[model samples]
Target: MATASETKATRRDFLYVATGAVGAVGVAGVAWPLIDQLNPDASVLALASIRFDIAPIVEGSSVTILWRGLPVFIRHRTEAEIEEARAVPMADLKDPQRDEDRVVEGHDQWLIMIANCTHLGCVPVGEAGDFDGWFCPCHGSHYDTSGRIRRGPAPANLVVPPYEFISDTVVQIG
Candidate 1:
């Protein structure tokens, strides 16, 4: 059997070990936010309005940008693609077009959408074909060129955030 002194020593050692473990966890918790702040591309800080030079986007091409920690899709639609989107019957769309759905006042060629699937928040890849839309491989959600939900399991249209055109070649997506 151990003496009283030995029993006291063992209890003290266990206490020290528990205290050290808690201290290490606390230090790590505090250090993680500091380390993340030091990262160059950290999004903890609020993003200011940014202007994108879109001259490189061809008439039929689309580009993706990270804005406020969300993927923004900016597609420069050709006249043919714009007509194709317009040709999609409202009866076929899950959410029929209203005047508010149109992003620009008088243009239907520039298609902008938040590149996130409405069902599960996955980024969808732009598939330019007969299924000319964004396809989410996660759960097979599909969005038309106008960001309207065409098929699959997504419940709503791809979001179109508040944005404005700074110029014919510059767009400010907030």
Candidate 2:
């Protein structure tokens, strides 16, 4: 342990280990950017989630916004619409989703769903369906005020996107 040659060998071993550690760190540093670049672009990531001001929409009115390359319908339901939606029996629905279940608990007046018809990709005509929800004229699919499939070719209800009320007037959808 006290010999000069032994001390030199120990120092050389430590230097080799230290250099190898640094080289591993350097390789990782070089590879990090390459790996991260493979992820989605900034613009694509920005479209993954969006916050929208819903205050401008009045009762019984709705607006369509693009989300992740799909048309998302955001409806501000009137009291009558909400009542009608709530009154429907579960047995009468083609796609049995409750009005209360389709909307956020406290914000029952807001209904957000994907606008495309379930049977086909046609956009439904709002406020024009048999049940006062949306009508897809392409295949005669009728949705209820709760966006539940009521009649015709659509096999299921309009898809509800993942969303939350950010504030009283703002909603974040993804």
Candidate 3:
């Protein structure tokens, strides 16, 4: 038979073990959410850079592609469009950016920019503005062929996302 002191000691040991297990569970419960919060969400992680082939886009035509849940306009500008954009003086523009600055060095025919209007985030219609560029009908913001804001309430030019011509006919955008 066990003495009273021995039985008391066993009970005390069991209490400590049970308490430690419960504490560990509590810590895990609290730490899981904290640890998980540090990781990026699924959708955010999926917003990586995307690529496009420029072979299909014809001159004087535009195509809208989705990048990071936003519309990106890829325009194959005609010679006339290129000339018009290049001829504009910086003083005439509301958002004064040079046409040459907006395009790739050797590939002046390709004009790539985000389609969202700088005024209020509206998607502009292609080749509909006075400058033959993009027109945001929602707020009357007009962008020139080089995606510079020509007229309207928009405070800035159309955004040009980071892009590189991986090949002569392929572009990667981020």
Q: Cα lDDT of all candidates, in order?
A: 0.78, 0.94, 0.91
TM-score of each: 0.68, 0.84, 0.77
Model 3: per-residue lDDT, tens digit, 39-102?
9888877777888999998888989999999999999999999999999999999878898888
Ranking by TM-score: 2, 3, 1
Model 2: per-residue Cα lDDT over 32-135, one tens digit each: 99999999998999999999999999988999999999999999999999999999999998888888888999999999999999997899999987999899
Worst 10 residues of 2 by lDDT: 1-10
Model 2 misplaced stretches (Cα beyond 4 Å): 1-12
Clashing pairs in 1: none
Give me the runs in candidate 1 sitting further than 4 Å from their true place. Answer: 1-48, 98-100, 128-130
- For model 3, where is the 10-residue window of minimal lDDT? 2-11
Give me the candidate number with maximum TM-score.
2
Q: For model 1, what is the error of residue 82's alpha carbon versus the real structure, in angstroms, after optimal superposition?
A: 0.7
By lDDT, who's the top model here?
2
lDDT of 1 by residue, 1-174 (tens): 876653445788989999999999999999999998777563444575567888898888898988877888988877766666778888888878742365686546677888899999999989642358788888887777777888888888888887788888787877
User: Whose TM-score is higher: candidate 1's or candidate 2's?
Assistant: 2
